[model samples]
Target: MADDPTKKGPADRTRVSTSEAHELRYWSEKFGVSHDELKRAVAAVGNSAEKVEAYFRDRSRDARR
Candidate 1:
């Protein structure tokens, strides 16, 4: 475990935590999404990073159509 998990990144990189502002910022930027969009992704997919990423990928693929 990191002394400061927020700064070092969470031990569980597979999940996204909206409770931490830093984490919200980190994920949103990482996924090229707005904070609200990231929150919506988490809400829709239960905070699993892989699912959120897939959600975006699917959305992008749909949008390309």
Candidate 2:
């Protein structure tokens, strides 16, 4: 592996379509959640970043109710 596997490559796509390890880590940090949670959101919302974000946003909103 390279010295920094998390470093994004030139072709690295968005996390939605290809949940690469680095992208997963980035999403996890960006969302302040675990990898599993991010995966769950993706799974629940079919890998659209907007949908996944909305899923979590709605989930959090529901939790606050």
Best by TM-score: 1
Per-residue alpha-carbon lDDT of candidate 2 for residues 1-65, written as tens digits (9 for 90 to 100)? 33355576413234363346766776777677889988878887787667877888899999999
Count of backbone collisions in candidate 1: 0
Off by more than 4 A, model 1: 1-8
Candidate 1 C-alpha lDDT tens digits along 1-65: 33453584666789998877778777888899999999998999898889999999999999999
TM-score (C-alpha, index-matched) for candidate 1: 0.86
TM-score of each: 0.86, 0.72
- lDDT score, candidate 2, position 24: 70
Return the number of clashes found in candidate 2: 0
lDDT of 1: 0.85
Quote the lDDT for 53 in model 2: 77
